[model samples]
Target: MKPNPISVVTFDLDDTLWAVRPVLLKAEDIVFDWLEEFAPKLTDRFTAKSFMKWRWDIYANYPELAHQISQLRTITVQLALEESGYSTAEAKTLADQAFEIFIEARHQVLPFETAIPMLETLKQHYRLGVLTNGNADIFRLALGQYFEFSFTAEQLNASKPLPEPFLAAQAHAAVNASEIIHIGDSLEHDVIGALDAGLHAIWFNPDDKEISADVTAKYHVNFYQVQCLSDIPAVIDTINKSRLHSRVTSP
Candidate 1:
């Protein structure tokens, strides 16, 4: 019997496996409380909304740090502290401490009901990995047990909808593009990016968003869509059967 054509499966971390907004909001609140205690002067200077604006300004000024989430965030904290009158050395220390608090709280996510079961089944059949634009580490969460490897935009210095991240994942898996699949929630970053990079992509569109005809025409690649994580294994099986039939029927 022939082997399964699809051997590797990579996933996006944030919204694909679990809701990110609540976790991030909670993390921010925790960080704010910590800052209030440790750096009361900084909290006195800026509210969350204004601090975010400052961070965006920093991002605009240093485009090179755009993909480096951890660095960018640390720098944002350091600058905010300095602006609030801390000395440079003091700000740097506080920034690192603040980031540590934020990151720890960030990992307190509640996974979707189906995320683990879906990963459990998929891992038994294919090499599983992660490719995420966010800094959420799978190893920090329970889902870490399901993945063999992971790549992040911050680590690679490249974000998706650009081909480098996808290409890097394919290389790491030691598989041809056709033999790998990338599953994620974002159409532009995950679906279109993976398809453009010559890999099969499954859009984890739980929101039931419509993929317009113009998107297909613009990308010139077709992709699979699934509303439920549980449907993924069946989609991969369908992809394998279709590839097998194509091989047998092709000239």
Candidate 2:
């Protein structure tokens, strides 16, 4: 069968392009340190580690925050400040400023060595965009120049492994689902989710994690894997060529 030629390449920002955990850990520390100096009562009441746990607690208690990551963060900070004895207005202002500090630090990511070069190559032939559940603003980072658009869970009102965000991306790119390829570090959110939504997927497994055989057998169509960032464009080229060969040989 002739492949639906790929046109739009969508990426999941967080762990796919860079190590998100370290970035988040550092951002958390920055936020807490800022709070320690400006809102000492909050720091006195809770350590940075405890503050992180409280943030998760708020996320767990509020189902509505599943897609509103920024709001969840802000609310967590505001509530902590209020509990630490700040007035409502003061807490709100402090929370907003604290989140700004966190996000700025969050953007200070160290991408893998070949990430930029790979994006540069891919962007020449494909329309690149971002689809993420996290708050990693691509435009805040140097790599944002390559992406044509970015869709967050907060903006789309749905998060992966849900199909809504994938479908929304397909619509936004004005391309058939089969013509789009989503690359991410997640098995469920990136590979299965994209395949389930009728788009292709490339699993960006830098750690070379094992995948259960059953998972692979289930969604074999248009699913691929790559351990190195530089291998992506080549794999994509192969997908198209193999499909073309199949088209020529089919009886």
* Model 1 CA deviation exceeding 4 Å by range: 1-4, 219-221
- Candidate 2 accuracy as TM-score: 0.95
Write down the worst ten-residue block by lDDT for model 2: 215-224
The whole-model lDDT of each prediction reads 0.90, 0.90
Q: How close is every model to the real structure, measured as TM-score?
A: 0.95, 0.95
Model 1, position 250, has a per-residue lDDT of 70
Report the C-alpha lDDT of model 2 over 11-58, residue by residue, as the tens digit: 998889988999989999999999999999999999888988887877
- The reply for model 2, stretches above 4 Å from the true place, is 220-222, 247-251
Shift of residue 190 alpha carbon in model 2, Å: 0.6
CA RMSD (A), model 1: 2.0
Q: lDDT by residue for model 1 over 79-165, one digit each (tens)?
A: 999999999999999999999999999999899899989999998999999999999899987789999999999888999978888
User: For model 1, what is the C-alpha lDDT against the true structure?
Assistant: 0.90
RMSD to the true structure for each prediction, in A, is 2.0, 1.6
